[model samples]
Target chain A: MPREITAFSNPLVKRVQALREKRHRREEGLFLAEGLRILTEARETGRVPRFLFFAAASAAHPLVRALVHAVEAAGGEAVETTPAILSKLSGKDNPQAVVGVFDQFETRLDQLDRGAASIFLVAERLRDPGNLGTILRTGDAVGAGGLILVGDCVDPFSVEAVRASMGALFTVPIVRTGWEEFLAWLRGGPGQLVGLSLQTEHDYRAVAYAAPTFLLTGNEAQGLPDDYEAACDLLVKLPMLGKADSLNAAVATAVMAYEVLARHR
Target chain B: MPREITAFSNPLVKRVQALREKRHRREEGLFLAEGLRILTEARETGRVPRFLFFAAASAAHPLVRALVHAVEAAGGEAVETTPAILSKLSGKDNPQAVVGVFDQFETRLDQLDRGAASIFLVAERLRDPGNLGTILRTGDAVGAGGLILVGDCVDPFSVEAVRASMGALFTVPIVRTGWEEFLAWLRGGPGQLVGLSLQTEHDYRAVAYAAPTFLLTGNEAQGLPDDYEAACDLLVKLPMLGKADSLNAAVATAVMAYEVLARHR
Candidate 1:
């Protein structure tokens, strides 16, 4: 039996709660993974968890047991904690029964391409975590090349982002790069650059996506900056007939991703 | 001169803030509309605002003045409120400087079919306000017949819902009905029922979307309930090759809406 830690005042519990903040997560070189789905995805991605905590009562689920056994076999630590203790460590008002503390992995853009024509999502200064997470999930679903976070934006690995992703964080490769560096890399790189904007004269449906593409999208309120707009080989807009100036960032990205998929298929 | 109320304890200010909760909104028969874009859209839709509140600093914008003048012309009232009061009434910690209060209106589904094939959205128990609001905007944009809300879902006229709708609430017609009643109506009505689900056997691209159609979508967690599944005449699913089981409710709905537009065009 792995030792059970019941006290809320435990040092480990305090540390886990602190990891909810970006500063603390960076300092500790770790991030939190919630729910059975995220943990299973992380394990499958070969990202080992440093510690696994589960509610003693929830340890009976076959999948949970298998996950725990797998963690133990890999020389990682597993501990059973009471539901109360698990909630305290999670710092969430409604915490799931199982949580894992995993080491953070940095993803490089080159790692996302798998030899063929790849589709990469390049988000420029998107501030909403839910939007970014939904985009990431959509990217994962479409088997996109990877994600490049450009400009100052929300941290894609933040708690809200991770939760909204529905376990896509483990499956999609993501790289955060400055605007100058990213544009320079794209100009010299192996993909055709596609930009999404409301001011674009050409309809997205009209664009022919024949080559490996780098799709660039902007924030909901303010769109891409002028310099980045100038860098695109093509700027396309989703047809808008309603009162809204444009679709939400995530929806727009999905529409574009689906279009790319349709062309490829 | 519209009086400027500053105190957070002001009765009107407190009442406006309480509008954030459904019970309070019902008790007061009022909902909050923020941002200039939303207010402008509301006016364009012919819904007059009962009260228009704005920051003293922004009172100089030509569009802002036009909004104030339009409200007075329509036999309504306009007021200049302190930034602090605007913040309090806006519900958000940082509210848009301008906010408006309008009486909620109800529309019946039968009135929507006037010499044309109707195209509308049927939302079943959608809990997320953002999803519901986005769907309303999309529906209005596509010139849908009307929106029919079913099950015990979030009220479509809430503050968050209004914000998300981007002022489409003023233009779109909405009706609410019980689950069994809605399903029965779909069976008896003249329109064809189309549903978006991940579990469906066929891809969305495989379905033919004709007008006089009612698109039924469900809550984020579960797809449309089992009882209502058979009610739809056609079922469509977006292709998913990635790890995540689904797309965001609103995103998928938008995709489906666009597909309908494409088929009609």
Candidate 2:
């Protein structure tokens, strides 16, 4: 049954809004992604939106209408409401015309390595949701095997991460893992491990980046830990010139990923 | 004398909040930059704050007090407000402990030339403020001669840009110029011109960045303009192997900037 949720006080709306908080998202195993582009990409990937909301006034736009129709066609609920109500649900002062609450993807690390040479991303303690999402998009662009979320990193499925990913979230495979297990896996790996660290004296360009390399990065404020430094066969530092001392984690990861791609090509 | 702004409803507060809007920032030729780090960096460079605001309660942090004291010592009026009021006036949802307003610097094109050979960044219609700010920091790090803002671009002093730049705004000389003049300047060339484009068939490493070069770039969404391609003495492309078309503008710019620095050293 397609439910029409109108009130901002509605339970479904509450649940959707709750997904914005990290703890709530962790507890509920759900995340909300907004905007038409993300919704379209989600639909194309056979993702069934659990709940979809749109501004009734903007229901006339072809893109909006199409998104509503797609949601409906997928047997998901499509509800129309005032922009004011939508804005309230969306923590953002200016809400996108459309939003969707989608089920959290359950991906296993073991399942990701099935029948393929894997080139994965391991992010440790990344605090910024936007950086995580940007990395997801860049990973998708690079056709990475999957992403391994490690340490105290922000939830990859959070609203901010999803929005920043530009719909790449739906396409990219992500596996959240404990740091200890991640370290063990890297140590046990036949695959190459490339650790990105600002402290490393070695230049990034010096690394070969051959084989199925697991490109690892850490938090923006802090780079990878010393214990995990031994896990990598090579520790590479992005060439930097400023007093800021380092590039943003997402930017560094993207540059290294591109380098890997460049070498392989 | 510098003005001490205390009340949240003060016209100065309203103007500072309006800095979040691009239109307001451009129309007024002013922008707000927060945090002690940025304020201190600006002050160190002889930039006199037009106004300064700080938290009234919670004197636990020594750095906060030192920053406020520094501002007041420099003949700048420092107004203390409640944490709530400070948060409201800071523009960001979670405000930094301190906020300040400074006069918008008007940099002339001719001011870029300082003595002998020097590298400069020339950006055409760079839309993303975050990217522009990152580029500015990178330029400062490499000791670039200056920056030339070509074509229609975002104001470099916007709040987002300022935050991303990490106080590089006060140090870097910026010259905003038109396309025709930019082309003439590059072509007439006090030095060689190095252009970055995704479509360029030549590898970036192949280019000799020996001379005082104008490193030219375009927007994140689009590469350099087709007409300006001929004006560049050298066109170089970052090597890529991913499904993603190219690196983010800031990352790409940083890579090229560092590469030039490496070659120069």
Candidate 3:
């Protein structure tokens, strides 16, 4: 039987709600993942949430019951809550039926196996959480090794990014490090650095991409710094045949990822 | 000389601010496009704003001055305003220095010149304004003819969509119509409708795309309805090598657009 918590003032509710902020998430060493589908994805990936909050309305749902079992089996708590509390935890007007608080993954560059996949996505100073999440989803679709965040990028674990990733965050490995540190790691392995740049004459499709290719994208507003572009093994440009000079950062990454995937296949 | 207005309660200020809402935009037949770069892109595309609002600080900027001149030349008013008013109009705490209120394009399927471009994008029931905007940007990047909305979709003139479009909203022609109407229009012309669907065994890259290819994508969640998929001349699916079942609507469209572009080239 799950604990019934009807009060919004419940301590556990406050703790989970506090995870909405980055500082609180960091301090708590956990993050929130909302929706039954996302939570199910997490469970399938061998990640059991520390706390599972479900509205009484969805407690009978087979997926919800399965998730409750998984949480209980993992020695985690399954709390039966109200929709008001669910909405409060999710910070949405209409919250999903379920919300899960899972321990944050402490991913590092050293843990990544570069030879495991052909393509790796590297973002430099990617500020938008939505873009970061979208890139993660694209990374998953292309069977990339992982997403490496170089320079000051948005927190991959942010709720906005986590939501945008469509559960790709649970499946894809993410590495956060500075540019020099990331470059050193790449240099230690067999990888080709391909920067998507406007300055390059080579078309993205024209390039012969090597295995273990790292597709690097720059900040949304500022393209890669001049030095960053210079360091790339190959610099390629997507054709901008219309008045708009650039594609959205995440869209460009997806297009490049698919191209790289096609070439390798 | 540009007229000066500092009061947020000013009638013109309220009118422009109201454009942030869809109902008000439809009522006025005008929409807001913020930022100097976007406004410049609009001007370059031969679409001048009916009213240009600029901060006092940016009034002397070369691009802003050029915009002012263009607005005056086009018999439009350039109002010098406060940053607070700019923020209020844009609904951003730190709004861009410039904002433009422009007449929304009245695009129709009949107005499209199918022979003008080799690629066209069609989206059905796309509810997200950001995804809609990103699709426009991708369409522009691939040199597609335009984006045609099938069925009930988010307003293309929404400010969020315009911002996400990165000024591609001005360059790309947008048509709003229902599915039956769009199919009839396409059948009346020389075109191939290729839809992105998971049900297809065909790979997106494996297909030979004809000139005037119409790439159709479904809603963010529901995807292409069964009947809609049946209507496509060809159905192609992007490979999902990971656990995530699908890509973000806009990202998937971009990947598909580029693949079609590559084949035609």
Best candidate according to lDDT: 3
Which candidate's DockQ is highest?
A: 3
Off by over 4 Å in 1: A1-8, A72-79, A82-93, A114-117, B71-77, B114-118, B187-189
True interface contacts reproduced by each model, as a fraction?
A: 0.54, 0.29, 0.94
The residue pairs that clash in candidate 2, if any, are A141-B244
Question: What does the lDDT read for residue B205 in candidate 2?
Answer: 71
If candidate 2 were superposed on the true structure by all CA atoms, what would the RMSD be?
4.2
Model 3 lDDT tens row, B101-176:
9999868899999999999999999999999999999999899899999999999999989999999999899999
From the highest TM-score down, the ranking of the candidates is 3, 1, 2
For candidate 3, give the lDDT: 0.93
Off by over 4 Å in 2: A1-28, A34-37, A51-74, A78-98, A114-119, A207-210, B1-30, B56-73, B92-94, B114-119, B191-200, B203-210, B222-225, B228-247, B259-265
TM-score of chain A of 1: 0.94
lDDT of 1 by residue, A38-78 (tens): 78877788866788899899889986887788888888888
lDDT of 2 by residue, A1-265 (tens): 2345577788877877888788898787778888877787788788857678888777888877777777778777888877776787777788989888787886776667722534678898889887888888777767788888987788788777887677778877888889878767656656788998766788877767766888989777768778787767889887655545556677778777767766666
Tens-place lDDT digits, model 2, residues B158-253? 877888887888777888999897666555546777888776789877767756877888876778878788777889987644444555677777
- Clashing residue pairs, backbone N/CA/C < 3 A, model 3: none
TM-score of each: 0.92, 0.82, 0.97
Chain B TM-score list for all models: 0.92, 0.89, 0.98
Tell me the deviation in Å of residue B40 in model 3.
1.0
